[model samples]
Target chain A: MWSWVAHRVTGMLIFVFLFAHVLDTALVRVSPEAYNTVISSYKNPIVGLGEAGLVAAVIFHAFNGVRVMLVDFWSQGPRYQRQMLWVVVGLWVVLFVPFLVRHLMHVFA
Target chain B: MSTIEAPRTQFRRSRATRSNYELWSWVFMRGSGLLLIALVFGHLLVNLVLGEGIKQVDFAFVAGKWASPFWQTWDLMMLWLAEIHGANGVRTIINDYAEKDRTRFALKTLLLASAGLILVLGTLVIFTFDPCPTGAATADVPSFCQTR
Candidate 1:
C-alpha cells in the first residue's frame, strides 16, 4: 500500500522535475552562456541537495517499477509480491547510498 | 445496476471509436520503464558520478558529448521516452484524483499542451544545436569549436 503511494508521489515529483529540466536544457540552444549561467546554479548547495533527492526518487521508481512489472506479468509474482517489495527496497538502498555519497562529495566539492 | 461485461466481450461502444488504448499504455509503461532505467542510470553515472561530477557539466561538456552521434542519439531517445512516460503517468494521476469532469479535462488539456510544446521544443534543440555559434566569445564555446 505504502509502496503504491510512494510510486505515485515519486513519479509525480520526477515528472515535475522533468518539465523544468527539459526547459533548462533547452537553454543550450539559446547560447552556451545562457545554458552555463543557468546550469551553474545547479551547483549551489541547496539545488545540489535537491538533485540528490531527485536521484533518490529516480532510483526508487526504477526498482519499484520492475517490481510492478513482475507483479503483473509473472505467474508466481502474486505469491512473491511481498518478497519482491523487500527486494525493491534492498536494491534502492544499495544503489542510492552510493549515489548519495558520490553526489554529495561532488556537490560539496 | 449495470452488468459487468465479461472479458473480451463485444463492446457496446462502436469498434471504430474504441481501441485498447489503456492496455497498450500499460504495456508501454512497463517496456519504457525498463529501458529508462538503463538510459537514466547511465546518464546519472556519467554526469554525476564520474570525474569532477556536476562541476564538469558546463556548456563545453555538453558540446563535447553532443558532438558524438552516440550521445546525441542516447539523449534523443531518453528525452522522448522519458517525456511520454512521465506525461502518461501524470494523466493517470489526474484521472484518479480529479473528481470534477471539467477540472480533469482542464488539467489534462494543460498537461497535453505543455507536454507537446516541450517535446517539440526539446527535439528541435537537440537536432539544431550548434556546437559553436558564430560570434560567441572563445571562452564560452567548446575547445574544438575554437579550431573552426
Candidate 2:
C-alpha cells in the first residue's frame, strides 16, 4: 500500500518538476537573460536541496517502475510480487548510493 | 475525507465493457514509465553531468542540443510521453477521489488542456528553434553567434 502511494506521489512530483523545467527552458526562446536568471535561481541552497529530493523521487520511481514491468511481463511474476518489491528496493539502493554521494558533493561544493 | 459524499471507484463504466482502452492505458503507463527512465536519465547525464552542470545550461547549450535531430527527437518523446503519462495518472486519481461527475470532468478537462498546450508548444519550439535571431543584441545571443 505504501509503495503504491509512493509511486503515485512521486509520479505527480516528477510531472510538476517537468512542467517547471520546460517553462524555464522555454525562456531561452523568449530571452536568454530571462532564462539564465531563472535557471540560476536554482543555484540557491534551498533549491539545491529540493533538487536532491527530486533525484530521490526519480530514482525510486524508475526502479520501482522496472519491478512493475517485471510483474506485468514475467511468467509467475505476479505470484512473487512481494519479493519483487524487495528486489526493487535493493536495486534502488545500489543505484542511488553512488549517485547520491557524487551529486550531493557537487550540490554542496 | 468527507463522509458527506462517498468517493468513486472509477468513472461510471461497466466492468464487463468490451473496450480495451483501460487495458491499453495500463500497458502504456508501465511501458512509458520504463522508457521515461532511459530518456530522463540520458537527459540528466548530458545536461547535468557532461559539462559544467546546470551553470553551463544557457542559450548556447540549448542551441547546441536542439541543433541535433537526435536531441530534438529525444526531447519530443520526453514531452509527449511524460505529459500523457501524467495526465492519465491524474485522470485515474480523479476517478478515484472525485465525488461528483461534473467535478471529475472539469478537472480532467483542465489537465488534458494544459498538457496539450505544452506538448504543442514544446514540439514547435524544439523543431523551429532559431539559434541566432537577427536584431537581437549580441550579448543576449548564444556567444557562438558572430553576425547576430
Candidate 3:
C-alpha cells in the first residue's frame, strides 16, 4: 500500500516536472529576451529549491523502482524486501547530500 | 528387458509459463534504463553546466537550442523513454500488489488515463509551442520577437 502510494505520487511529480520543462523550453521560441527572463527565474533561490525537490523526486522514484522490480520478479527478492527498503533509504541519503550541496552553491554563491 | 520397461516414470509439471509480454517488458526496462541514464545526464549537464550554465538559460537561449533539430530529438527521446519506463514500472507494481481484480482494473484504468493524457499533452506542447506571440504589446514580447 505504501509502495503504491509512493509510486503514484512520484509518477505525478515526474509528470508535473515534464510539463514544466516543456513549457520552460518552449519559451525559447517566443524570443531570446523572454527566454532569458524565464531562465533567470530558474536561477532564483526559490527555483533552486524546486530543482532540489525535482532531484529528490527522481532519486526516490528510481531507487524505489528498483525495489519494486525486485519484489515483483526476482525469486529471492521478496524475502529481502525490508533490507532493500533500508538500502533505498540509505542510497537516497547518500545521493541527496551532494545534490543539496551543489544546488545550494549554485543558488547562494 | 521386462524390468527396464517397468521403470518408466511420470512427467513433472513445469513451474513457470512462457510469456512474451513479460519478456518484452523485462527487456524494455533494462534497455530504457540504460538510455535514460544517458538522456538524463546529458539533460543535466547541458542545463546545469555548458556555456553560461543555469544562469544563462532564458527565452532566447531556449529558442536557440530548439531551433536546432538535435535538441528537439533529444527532448523527444527523453520524454518517451522516461514516461514509458515509469509507466511500465507502475504497471508491474499494480499487478503485484492489487489483490482484487476490480481494484487492479480500476488502478490500471487510472494509470493508463493519466499516462495517455500526459503523453499527449507533453508532445503537443513540444511541437506546437510558439515562442513569438503576434499582436502582443511590445513590452510583453521578447526583444527578438520585435525584430522578427
Model 1 bad stretches (over 4 Å): B1-17
| Candidate 2: residue pairs that collide | none
**DockQ, all candidates in order:** 0.85, 0.52, 0.21
The full ranking of all candidates by DockQ, starting with the best, is: 1, 2, 3
Scoring only the A-chain of each prediction against the true A-chain gives TM-scores of: 0.97, 0.90, 0.90
Return the candidate ranking by lDDT, descending: 1, 2, 3
For candidate 2, write residues B14-77 as lDDT tens digits: 4577789999999899989889999988987787656666556767788878867899899999
Which candidate leads the pack in lDDT?
1
Off by over 4 Å in 3: A1-16, A19-47, A56-99, B1-19, B51-55, B136-148
TM-score for all models, in order of appearance: 0.93, 0.87, 0.62
lDDT of 1: 0.92
The sequence of per-residue lDDT tens digits that candidate 2 reaches over residues A19-51 is 777777788778767777787777766886787
State interface RMSD in Å for all models: 0.8, 1.9, 4.8
Candidate 3 docks at the CAPRI level of incorrect
Best by TM-score: 1
